[model samples]
Target: MRTIIGWAVLLLATAWVGAVEIKRPVDMGFVPLRAVSYEEAVELCTPLLSKDGKLTYAKIKNLLVIHDYPENIEAVKKLLAQIDEDPVNVRVDIFMDQAAQEKSSSFDVNLRNVRVEHRDGHTRVDGGIGISAGQGSREMSGSTNPFIMAGNGRPARIWVGETVADPVWVYEYGMGQGWWKQELVNRDLGVSLWVLPRVLPNDLVEIEVYPRVTARGSTPLSVDVKELGTKVVVQNGATMPLGGLDSSRRDAYRRILGVGSVFNGSNLSISVRPTIMRMPERLRQEKARQDQPPEKH
Candidate 1:
């Protein structure tokens, strides 16, 4: 009976997606989901985005600042101007292609109180985030911090690129019934996902999701935590300041929040979450590099 019900919900979700190009100014909602066990995450995933068949991506430009640059003061002022000018279709040139690249999909939107501080001759950035939904586990330790400018603070700059993680879907066909007398049992992935419906077109929706997998002692297990990501819906004209907490390099203080990266684990389990990297920033940086005179060294 449970299996039949699950299939019903999944079908309904599929019916909800509108088979059309996403139009703007979109009535977008950000959802961030977290799950400690695989089942928990998948619970909410079954029926996601079914009501609104249309989807769209918001263009987010990262602002990396080097305070020591001659144009440091002007840059911040100008970046703010760019963000202010359009609010949407923001324009800022990221200097390194490696600095920003885009793969697709994003999740974090509750960024606030961002700032960089110097500690022990290394640039240390500190910030905090509050999720308004889902009781996500803090046990899955990974880099949720922003990508630092230089990781070491040298050539010091607060670099911004693109980063986003959005959940796709969840549907399962039972292979067979649980045996009444099973000799061995194991749960490699334990997770669940929660979905909060939108009451309005412009609602602040956040979904926090993660994977929970475990193998009993002496039980060899290998599995992949597939497509574990985030979703966020923010009000109009909302911007979140960014800073990160991960060592990009030695003697450097930087956090990389871009997509297309992995959260590798030693327990024969790997989590693939997309990091945000930018496109224009990479191209713009390349142009400047080419224009620079050949290295004197």
Candidate 2:
């Protein structure tokens, strides 16, 4: 009986150790936004935006200052205008605690504090814009399969140099799916393709591309067939469609397709980019070469 009791104690101790080992450093709420001089705020938040007007993932360790002195409003506006022109390097400071940060792991931006300081009196506002991280997982579930269908009876082949303006269906996991109307579908050869309904990390998804065509003689047609391909896995909010392409590929693909790209992620943020019409064939060849069995060198 003593031995059995000892074993139980040992088991409990082991479980406790395991639990403690798995405990990660709690994410403290984001650094708060404090009132600061115009120069100070600009200097602090500039690093948050990249050169392309996109927010960077780097955590802001400094307080954000907005000179809200009524006299300084125009100056603040001018400073904000400059930051807007180069938004990639600009970020608004919002206060967050460790729990809130963890709860919003997929969010790109957070807003918690809004204080407006004026010479007459200081006022703390309660609202601001918050941008969350894009969804990284794409799974299809429901009675109806989410797929793009062609219009005509004939098998539609969306070839290079073709443009398709149709409602693109986005398959969101957990949330009821919705459709984006007039999505420009471009089938440029060797160009990058961006699909909606964001994917999550380590998620494997199958993407289907379809072309619309009209049947001859005005006969009504069923939805066209779809072409299937493996979609690239997402690292953060963004991903490259073709394997082996870097983050820059997103812009490159847009340029090659001449169609706008919009990606909606888990955070409910929709990112839109203008159309591009071509992708480098050289990159595709390089990928194919790497995928092939190593040759005797």
Candidate 3:
């Protein structure tokens, strides 16, 4: 009887360890700089960001261009015509509720009236530069046991399975690489479903989640997908576990499981942040980012 009890405790401990839980979510706050003026702010200071601040910078710049600075290029030209211009200040206060607490989050940066101060014979470019990493809102969906259909970070057709699937999911979470997924319980094995883009044929290049993430076992954990109802046989380690699956995302997970089910399964559809994605899609996102205007709150 003692042996039976001990084994039960051991199994329970294993499941508990493997269960997903949210570690500290991606730090989606303002990365405050030395507060340089618009003119002195060289090249947007893209490197100082937590991760690649290119896309985040693009978004911020778009905000400035549209409502503050060159958005009104004609107005800017007019200002240049004047010598000692009036002080124009565009206060940045972006506010956004915690949308995708697990995956990512963002806030609204308010675009105040441009403060046109002609300092040292030059009309300073209105406001200084500030960046907020992981700065975007997400209406997240679903929760599951990391039971994602292995494919193009999208819904996999039930009947087609891996044949029509996109092999792997590539997610680059270097923003919080150091302390993102801290080990919760001693034997905690919780999983978060991360669907990455297919850079090549089967690109499963994953940078370590936490330094000790490998303690879980392997990068693409091969598990049974039959639990999610797919003839695909097994999960192709496409979606990796990040943290514990909470109640908030249960709805979205249902659709992902249902999506492939011909009878009743929710389709998994997600908007990939091009700025944080790989090539092909990255290129497409860059074009879209350039062609698009500043997003309205």
Predictions in order: lDDT: 0.30, 0.33, 0.31
Question: Mind giving the per-residue lDDT tens digits that candidate 3 earns over 91-177?
Answer: 111111122323346654655555777778987667554545554433544322321222232222212122222244444477656
> For every model shown, what is its TM-score relative to the native structure?
0.16, 0.17, 0.15
Please state the error at residue 140 of candidate 2 in Å.
Answer: 61
Summarize candidate 2's per-residue lDDT along 113-224 as a digit string, tens digits.
Answer: 6666555575556668788666454342111112122211112222333333444555445556664544444332333232332222253222222222221233332233
Best first by lDDT, ranked: 2, 3, 1
Positional deviation of residue 9's Cα in model 1 after best superposition, in angstroms: 58
Give the per-residue lDDT of model 1 (tens digit) for 181-236: 32333333322222221212333322222222222334333333322323343332
Q: Is candidate 2 or candidate 3 better by lDDT?
A: 2
RMSD of each: 30.0, 34.3, 35.3
Distance from true location, Cα of 84 in model 2, Å: 27
Q: Judge candidate 2 against the unseen true structure and give its global Cα lDDT, from 0 to 1.
A: 0.33
What TM-score quantifies how close candidate 3 is to the native fold? 0.15
The candidate 1 region of ten consecutive residues with least summed lDDT is 86-95
